[model samples]
Target: MIHRPRRLRTTPAMRALVREGALTPANLIYPMFVREGISEPTPISAMPGQYQHTLESLADAAREAVEAGVGGLMLFGIPAHTDPTGSQATSPDGILNRGLRVLREAVGDRAVIIADLCLDEFTSHGHCGVLDSEGRVDNDATLPIYAEMAVQQAKAGAHMLGLSGMMDGQVAACRAALDAAGHTDVAILSYAAKYASGFYGPFREAVDSQLKGDRRAYQMDPANRAEAMIEVELDLAEGADVVMVKPASHYLDVVADVSAQIAAPVAAYQVSGEYSMLEAAAANGWIQRERLIAESLTSIHRAGARMIATYWAVEAARMLRNSL
Candidate 1:
């Protein structure tokens, strides 16, 4: 009884002082969607409060994120055109590249601008890579495209590339391309342990992904935890500056495992479905929205994620700042 844990819970100050994990704006990386040929920002219905921003509005959003003291911004593009090879992804004028340029011009080193280096948003088939004669995702054929995309993104002022396609040897391919282009300074943030999970449902809508089939062939299987470590090690060996685990809430074990095994900075993506579920619960009056958001982020941090990519980054950052 003398060891009463109630002593620490007696006061807010005591609780604050004894807090084991801290969630701050510095730990956040906001994910943004940019669309081509739009005059204004358009709300994503499935993921309420998230938008597919036009160029001008994207600049505004970037500035707002920077002002919120968020650590980084990640961009995904919805292009006006789509093709089998996702050729637009490697174009400097591509929506994602353009968004990166806009953010670079607006934020001006205030926040790290990350480009999502994947083709699912641009490919007509909605696959992450090019298809073979058999209509399967040709892993080797995808490397050159990713290589070109990396250089294009680097040239567009992306401070880091989020290699989210989950292809084999993608990290090495991108690294080689970047270094060859004299973009050795641009870092690669590899989605080292991305799973082909049902949790990605909302994201497909957010990006207007036209995928006819599942990405299981390329993306990691959800049931295997040890496979995540192998993926992380492969990414590290290929020069990934940061390694990330996607749909973070369900994969904290993977996040913690990767964090323990690697020297590279660990990132966890609190993906679209994770965001939508919280929003849905809040709308139904089932949970305290603000508290849940903060707690969710705290849990990820406690699980050893050094950086978090979340739709609620700006709002969570503001809440954290206000709490202080």
Candidate 2:
């Protein structure tokens, strides 16, 4: 009886005080979709509550997140056109860049603005990079475009560029480009251990992705754990201010591994499919939605993620605040 551990679980107050990972609004980053040539917000079919926002609506939402004390806002763009090279990804007037501008003007410096630096949303072929004549993604050819895109995103007022593209040397290329363009102050958030996961299906719908083939060529294989360390190490060497592991809940081991070795802050994404599954279960009355959300986020943090990119950021932030 003297050794009973039930004392901690007996009271909500005891549980709160004993929690190892305290998830605050400061630890959450809200990911959003912004579309060009849309007057009204377009609801994403796969993500019931999320929308491909118009400039006005995107700004409004950024302000809302800022008000909620969320740490950052990540912007993904959908353009009116697509091309073989994903040209708009580097354009100053690109939807992502424009959304960055709108967010800056809307929220000022209240929250960090992180741009999704990838081509899948803009390319006609739906791949993350331009295809060679043989139709394989040309990795070296993609670097220059990514470099230019980084400079443009920096000019657009992104506090940090989320390099989601899995191209080799991308972190170096983007860091060089940002510094050369006098954006030395802007940071890089490298998706160092991104897996080619089935969980991205809902994200494809959210961004209006036109991709016909899988990104397995560049993205890490889901089965590989050791390779994540290699990727994370390379990214850190190449000047990534922060490093990330994607599909966080499924890859907490990778998150924990990366965190254990690096001095840089670690980030993990609870991607679209993860969000959808939780939403579906809640709608079916299978689980308490808010409790699960808080629990899942806390688990990711406990697994060593210093930051978490999630669709439920705002609501979760509010939840954490209320618990105190």
TM-score of each: 0.98, 0.98
* Candidate 2 local lDDT, 93-154, one digit each (tens): 88889999999899878899999998889999999888999999999999999999999998
lDDT of 1 by residue, 1-324 (tens): 779888898888999999987778988999999999888888889999999999999999888988998999999999999999998998888888888889999998899999999989999999999999999999999999999999999999999999999999999999999999999999999999999999889888788889988899989888999999889999999999999999899999999998887778999999989999999999999999999998899999999999999999999889989999
Q: Model 2 clash tally? A: 1
Q: How close is candidate 2 to the true structure, as a TM-score?
A: 0.98
Give the Cα RMSD of candidate 2. Answer: 1.1
lDDT of each: 0.93, 0.92
Off by over 4 Å in 2: none
Write down the lDDT that model 2 would get.
Answer: 0.92
Worst 10-residue lDDT window, candidate 1? 255-264
